[model samples]
Target: MTAQAVIQVFILVLILAGGILAVWLRDLLAAVIALAGASLLVSLEFYILQAPDVAIAEAGIGAALTTAIYVIALRRTRRKEKE
Candidate 1:
């Protein structure tokens, strides 16, 4: 396969791993961080796919704003899992 394809595949793998970690982690903050990582990776993938607008939106909203909101909410709550 081509180098670009390989890179895309690698990014996809990272995104999948991040999603799994976000679900599996017991710590809420850690989970959020993982989700943000996934979002950032998705934005990067979008950019690589020639969709700069979507990439910027995803990076700004999904990675930055969403993470900020989550962190702010997290600050007012517990960080550990209950189970």
Candidate 2:
């Protein structure tokens, strides 16, 4: 197989695994981490598709902001659960 095909398969696996983990994982934090990985992979795919603006937005908003928000929310709720 060609290198490009191999890379494509790898990316596809990452994306699918991330999706599955995000859905099936019981821990909120782990789901967020998996989703962040998916976001980064999507951003890379966008870059490969020659959409720099979309890639940047996905990296910043999808990977960074979403992850930060989810983590913070999880911490907050977990603290409440402990109380």
Candidate 3:
């Protein structure tokens, strides 16, 4: 396989790992961080695929904006108190 192909595969594997970690983590903040990492990797993959516009959108919206929103939401949530 070509170098580019190998790199793409590696990135894909990392993305999958991040996704799994996001799902498996008990901490909400950690899960958000893992998801953000996967989003960034996806943006990088788009850039490597020659889609710069999509990559930029994914980085800005998927990685940055979405992560910020999730973090803010998580911060505002309160745990239920035992009666």
Clash-forming residue pairs, model 1 = none
Model 3, position 36: C-alpha lDDT score:
98
**How well does candidate 2 match the true structure in TM-score terms?**
0.85
State which candidate has the highest lDDT: 1
- Tell me the tens digit of each residue's lDDT in model 2 across 1-83: 98877887888899999999888787778888999999999998888778999999999999999999988888768622222
- Writing each residue's lDDT as its tens digit, candidate 1 over 26-70 gives 999999999999999999999999999999999999999999999
- Arrange candidates, best TM-score first: 1, 3, 2
In the predicted model 3, the residue pairs found to clash are: none
Better candidate number, 2 or 3, judged by lDDT = 3
Worst 10 residues of 3 by lDDT: 74-83
Global lDDT of each candidate: 0.98, 0.87, 0.92
C-alpha TM-scores of all predictions: 0.97, 0.85, 0.91
- Candidate 3 lDDT for residue 75: 74
Write one digit per residue (lDDT tens) for candidate 3, span 2-81. Answer: 99999999999999999999988777888899999999999999999999999999999999999999888887884222
In candidate 1, residue 64 scores what lDDT? 92
Candidate 3: regions farther than 4 A off:
78-83
